[model samples]
Target: MKRQTHQLVLAILADLEVYLKTELDNVVIYDDGRGNEDVFFRITEKEHLPLVASLVKKYNGRLVTLTPNVIDDETHELVYHFDIEGLLINCTITVTDKKIPSITPILKSADWTEREMKDLFGVVPEGHPNPKRLILDESLAEGVFQEYIGLSDAMAGAATNKLWEHINEAKRKRD
Candidate 1:
């Protein structure tokens, strides 16, 4: 049942890559082997990102979320989660370029998700209509979440407190 649907999705993706003139092997799909039926795909090429997103949408896949993580001092990884029928497909892109193009035009829901990455990781989301801060105050600083980068204790505590106060104030305003 679920396995069959998963296989169908694989076939759909393969056909899509062929139509898009992309290398199907580059879209590597693998599971964690935990018998949990969760599937993952690491889209190995940067240029094919939008094509993959388009294919997912063509298959009626919905963008669940997008997340970013500092992969290293020089790079960050952007991951996208999409749901096709009952199957989940994940696409990851490792970006060394400070500016990555926004997929909002394709995913629509990626508007804020990419903005969050931009605000927190300092990875610029080029072409983002509203390239404004999503999670941090303009005064605090970007890349505060990067644990690899050392920060002074005074700065760290101050940034944390500022963030806390901002959150509380926003909540108060909402209420």
Candidate 2:
């Protein structure tokens, strides 16, 4: 990350922070201190996601990736990684809601990412155009995070086998 790019990102983030505070409550920003990497901001209010997405779009950022992190038993952190002008901004929203508004309406790249989150976390992407399965099999249950309970022995064994087979296939293809 160039010094100029770093400063530019910081400035944009600072502006976003101020804006976020004014528009939404319980927003916290964390700087990883590793230059141009690993910055996180958490939005406590799920309703504010659309506004956050709008701000990211206004800054000409592209939604790079979205990840569902099982933070705790009742909470899942929906991390929306956005890249703007060579800077990565990770906006995380801790969700307990069964559904959250879709950002794909604003960021076209969110289409598949939102669906993937829904499939994996069972976090419904409300208003998503195509909220279909991404990588999960129809037979396997959703929200089956590795650490999650209620995972049956048979299902776990089947998944482990499928995973190994998929990994071996990729290795074979590469070879």
Candidate 3:
């Protein structure tokens, strides 16, 4: 039943890759090895977004949601979640100059997704209409905040609070 649908999705993905000549692999399907059925896929980059979207349409799949995972001081990647009929799939794509492609063109829902990816991961989606900061404060300087401020959440919070305290103290002295 469920296994049949999962197999169908894998087949459709393989077929789509053939038609698009794109690198779409790292297909992962998880079901806890139990009664529940869950499926997922790990994509390559933005270049495959269109092909993925096309496959989704051709197979009656739906783009449910996407999230950009920024690996601070290392690598950044985007993870997309899709639901095909009754099967759920998750795909992760790393951002690279060679393969980085924009998904905004294929799905309007991807506009902000791309922007947020750029904002947090610094992966610029080539054709994003508004690739502005989605999570970061636009008023702050680029990378500087993340550099001198540090990357870890605990460290960043402490560092930021200390910096603000110093600024506030300096103002008090003047007044």
lDDT tens readout by residue for model 2, 35-121: 544456777777778877887788887899998887676677788998877677788787876578998988887888888887777
Q: What RMSD value applies to candidate 3?
A: 6.3
Could you tell me which 10 consecutive residues in candidate 2 have the lowest summed lDDT? 23-32
Q: What would the TM-score be for candidate 3 when compared with the true structure?
A: 0.63
Put down candidate 1 lDDT per residue, 32-88, tens digits, no spaces.
454234456566566677777787777877778887878787688888887777667
Off by over 4 Å in 3: 1-4, 20-25, 32-36, 72-74, 96-99, 135-137, 142-175
Q: Candidate 2: lDDT over CA atoms?
A: 0.74
Q: What is residue 37's positional error in candidate 3, in angstroms?
A: 3.9
lDDT values of the candidates? 0.72, 0.74, 0.64
Of candidates 3 and 2, the better by TM-score: 2
Residue lDDT tens for model 3, 33-123:
5434565666654556677776766676766777765555556666777667766667677763423567666666667766665665556
Instruction: Sort by TM-score, best first.
Output: 1, 2, 3
Best candidate (score: lDDT): 2
Residue 114 lDDT in model 2? 85
Q: Which ten residues in a row have the lowest lDDT in candidate 1?
A: 29-38
